[model samples]
Target: MTSTDELLVKEITVSRQSSGEERRLALHQIYVQVLERQPYAFERKQLAKIEADFLRNKIGVKRFLRELGHSEVYLNAFYYNSSNPKFIELCFKHFIGRAPSDQAEMRRYCDILMRQGVRDMITALLDSEDYSRHFGCFTVPHAWAEASYPSPRTFWETEVLLHELHGRRGWIVPTMVWHDLQLNCDGGSCRLPEPSLSSAPSSRTAAVISGSEALHQVLSTMGPQDLAAFAATLSTAERDKLRHLLMQSVQ
Candidate 1:
C-alpha cells in the first residue's frame, strides 16, 4: 500500500495509449487497491462490464468507484452481509479511505442510504469534497489511519477496525459497536477521553465559499433531482451558502 506521502509524491493514472496487457494490469491493480480483492480476481467475470468500460476509458477512476460502490458484488460483500452502520463504515474505508470520525458522520451516510438507496448514497460519497480532496479522479484510496487519527488509541483502533474487522472473518461487530467495546467500561467506572475535533485530520476546520465540482456539476445539469442529491452531499455551511444563492436568484 502506498503511503499518503507517496501518493503526494506521484499520483498514479493509466495512460490511454497503454497496451492491452498494460490495461489488464492497471485493472488488476484497481481491483486490489479499491476492492481489496485478489489481484487476479477481476479476471473471473465480476463486474466485467465496468472493467471493460474502464479498459475502454469510458469512465475515470471516480466514476468506476461510484459504480463499484452500488454494484451487486460490493453490496453483497459489504452491505447485505453487515448491518447498515457497518456498511457505511466499510464505504468510508473503501471510498474515502478512512474510518468515519464518529457516529454523526455515519448517520449522515446511513440516512442517505435509507432514503435514497445505494446508488444515491454512493453518489453522495463519491461526489463528496472529502473524496475530491484526498483522491480526486485519479489515485486509488488508501488508509489514512496512520497519519490522520488524533491520538494513539484512535489510530490503533481504526487500524484494527479497517483491516481486521470483517464479517467474512466472523467479526460481526459494526463500526461504533466495536468502538464502544473498546471505549466503554463496566459500571460507568471509566472516563473515556472525548474524541477531539482535531481528530478528523482530513476534514476542513471551516467551510469554504467556493463551489465544489459537485455544485458545478449540478449547475450544469440544471435538473432538480441532481440538484437535490448534490445538495445532500454538502456540509451545513455549504448548504446554507447554496440556499442563500438560490434565494437571491429568485428575488
Candidate 2:
C-alpha cells in the first residue's frame, strides 16, 4: 500500500490497543504536547506516579490536571511572575486549546480566580462540556486553535500568547502589551519608547525594518544612482522621518 494508507493502518492499529494502554499513551502525549518540552528525569517519575493514581481511579481528570498544573515544572514554565490576565489567557489556551471567545469569558474566569482560586478555575475548564467532548480525559489538547476551527479573536495569538506562557524561554518579548508601551533602555539607562506599529511604514520592506540592518537591507537592492533618485523623490517630511528612524537605530 501507499505511505498514506500504511500510516493510517498504523494509527488504526494503535487506536485498537487496550483502553488502559491507550489512556497511558494519551497521558504521556498530553505531558509532551501541553508542556511543549520533554520532562526531566524526576518529572517523568512524578508524572508516572500520578498516571498510576489516575489509572487506579484514585484521582479524577480535573484532579490529575490540578496536580500537574501545580508541579514545579508547570509553575516555572507558565505561572512564574505572570500577570493575572496573562495567566488566565494561558490556562484557556494550554488546557482548553483556544483563546477566550470574548472579554466576558476571560472576565468570568478571572472572577472564578478571585472568588475561588486557580485550582477551581482549572477544574471548571477541565469539567466543561467542550473540554470533555473534545479531549475527554486521555486525549492531548492541540495548540493550533485555527486549524480545526476559526479563532474567535482577530489574530490566532500563537506567537504572543505562547511567548506570554513561556516567558523568558520565548525568543521575543513583545515591546507593547495592550496599553503598556514599554521604554527600551540602553547601557546608559536612557529610556525611549519605540514607535507603535501603526506609525511604522506600511511598505512590506519598511514594516520589517527595526534598525539600521533592515534599512541597509532595503537600500542594498538599489544601485548607487537609484539611491540618489529615490532620495530625490522623498518629501521633506519623509526625509525627516527617515533621519529620525536612522538615529533611533544607531542609538
Winning candidate number (lDDT): 1
Estimate TM-scores for all models.
Answer: 0.60, 0.54
Query: Poorest 10 consecutive residues of model 2 by lDDT?
Result: 4-13
What's the CA error at residue 118 for candidate 2, in Å?
Answer: 1.4
Residue by residue across 71-169, what tens digits does model 2's lDDT show? 766767665544445566677767776656544565677677657876777778888876776677645565443434335342334434444324432
lDDT of 2 at 198: 65
Per-residue alpha-carbon lDDT of candidate 1 for residues 26-124, written as tens digits (9 for 90 to 100): 566666555677424543477888878887877767778787776777776676545455566677767776666654566677678777887898789
Worst 10 residues of 1 by lDDT: 205-214
Give one clash count per candidate, in the order shown: 0, 0
lDDT of each: 0.56, 0.52
The predictions' CA RMSDs to the true structure, in order, are 13.6, 14.1
TM-score: model 1 vs. ground truth: 0.60
Candidate 1 ranges with C-alpha deviation above 4 Å: 1-11, 15-22, 39-46, 149-154, 165-172, 183-251
**Whole-model lDDT for model 1 versus the true structure?**
0.56
